[model samples]
Target: MTPSAIPGPIDPPARLLMGPGPISAYPSVLRAMSAPLVGQYDPYMTQLMGETQELYRGVWATSNDATLLVDGTSRAGIEAAIVSLVRPGDRVLVPVFGRFGHLLAEIAERAMAEVHTIETAWGQVFAPSAIEEAIVRVKPTLLALVQGDTSTTMNQPLDEIGAICERHGVLFYSDATASLGGNDFEADAWGLDAATAGLQKCLGGPSGSSPITLSERAVEVIRSRGRIEAGIREDGDASAADFVRSNYFDLGMILDYWGPRRLNHHTEATSMLYAARECARVLLLEGRDAVIERHRVSGAAMLAGVEGLGLTVFGDVAHKMNNVVAVEIPAGVPGDAARAALLEDFGIEIGTSFGPLHGRVWRIGTMGYNAREDAVLTTLAALEQVLRRFGASVPAGGGVDAAADVYRGAA
Candidate 1:
């Protein structure tokens, strides 16, 4: 256990990540993280930060001035949005379709809000009518939902839900961590008060930064709860018991840090800032619509290829995200063992299921840099061998051949 006895420098095996998330980052993102760091308040750093904010505005399809990155994972962004907007005793309605929906409710509860949730079957999503009924019944101040839940690979329909919230005079927020970039999301056109996403999914970056957008109404609510810290406040500054519960997650303070005022909150995460900036730059440079179409084609190919291998896909095909898919584990193939074989034998990594689907399905992802024709075909080929080795009957080259047909059709 001595230092000298340890292996030389850090090194990792090359892996083709076809999992639900934390996929292999784009080469440009990795390189961006290694760029030289500068002082937090350096002019160049501030300029870069401003540019990142603008770039994310385009990515989120919003005109909100509050669009920026949270210095943590996607969950941090979720917490920041919920805790800042919902005060203790405030009523919040959450429609639970999968694990992440439960997460939104939990974070709201932790912030001392009266959280109410309506549930649907895991493989399905809530109808617009169901959500409207909940909003009317709960009379909540906020309607929090997940746009995409990787656990079930279901994308909740937000297009109509936003209008439903608007009719009821409620704030609408969504966690698009797994759907953004690969899917079609319109923050402004859809009437979203707040939305958050992470870069690891379809943005082809690591998990440190979370991009968030807040409509003007959402900002006004957050502003009412703002309380400047003692260290930064001067005489005549105001404080109250109703200040945001967690200073670190207070969107008001974070906004001040990112805004033109340039107030010091926390030292900005410099390296992650570079990576996030590059991720948005790459997406915009390629054209957002073109990137989404690429994901659609790749996701379709993966779906067809799995069916070609005689495996059933979970969830309603119409509701699935264009990034990840869940396929039922063959009747007798040891699920975990099969996944391990894929990793060790072929240097590929697919995902395992959670909750109700555990041990029943394997989650395969075609997202970000991995959402390509070659990645889809390679994963299908490797997965076929693993299934056959595990005693599941798989036609030779069936998966890859079927996936190739999808690519050809797209061409």
Candidate 2:
């Protein structure tokens, strides 16, 4: 473990990322991250932050002024929104459909909010009426949920859920970390109070930074707790809170860093901001619709391929996420062994399920830059070989042929 004992530099072997997140970064994004670094307060760096915000606003489909990047990963953005908005004793209602929903509940608990949950079976989404019933019963101050749960590869229906929150006067927040860039999301139209996402999964970038947007109401709630310094106060000025708890995750100060005032918070993560910017740039240049369409087609191909491999898909087929698929493990097949073989022999990575789905399903991702014909074909072909080796009765060339038909239809 000593320095001299350390081995020489090693290059990474190329592999297709077909897991939940931190998916393969695009070549352009990697190059952007490697560009020369600058001081935190450099004018060019500030401009980069501004442009990054603008880019995310378009991706989020919102015009909120409070859009900015959280320095850490996607979870940082989740904590920033929840801790900033939910005061102690505030009622926060979370809907538990998958593991990520439980994550929201856990974070809200850490923030000292009184948490309530509307529970649903994994791989299933709550109906609008079900959510409305819970909201009316609990009268929660805040409602937090995930747009897509990568653990189960299911996208929760949002349009009606947003409406229910609005009707009940509850603030709506969503974690779109798994769905953004690959699926359709409309923050403003969907009436989201706050939405946060990461660049790694579908945005074709690394996982160091998070993109977040706050609606007007979300801004107002955070502003109520804004801090004011003695030196900065004037005779007629309004005083603010003495200390905003959790300084590092404070969105108010983050807003200041992103706003016209341009105050310092943490030194902006230069490489991560550059990567996030490039991710957005790639999506924008491709046109948002085109990017979404690409995910749709690729996901369809993946679905057809998996089915053609003589495996059954889990969950309601219509409710699946656009970038990830869940397939049931065939009877008597060693799921773990198949996945390991896919990685070791074929240089492809797929995900295993969690919670109730443990040992029951294999999750495969078709996301970001990896959502292409070649990636899909490679994964399908590798999976067929592995399954056949494991004694599954997969027909020869069936998976590849089915996927080819899907691609042909798209063309």
- Which candidate gets the maximum TM-score versus the true structure? 1
Model 2 weakest 10-residue run by lDDT: 234-243
What are the Cα lDDT values of the candidates?
Answer: 0.93, 0.90
Q: Please state every model's RMSD to the true fold in angstroms.
A: 1.6, 2.4
At residue 189, give the lDDT of candidate 1: 89
Model 2, stretches more than 4 Å misplaced? 1-4, 226-244
Tens-place lDDT per residue, model 1, 161-219, is 88888999999999999999999999998999999999999999999899999999999
TM-score of each: 0.97, 0.96
Candidate 1 error regions (>4 Å): 1-3, 231-241
lDDT of 1: 0.93
- Look at candidate 2 and tell me the lDDT of residue 94: 95
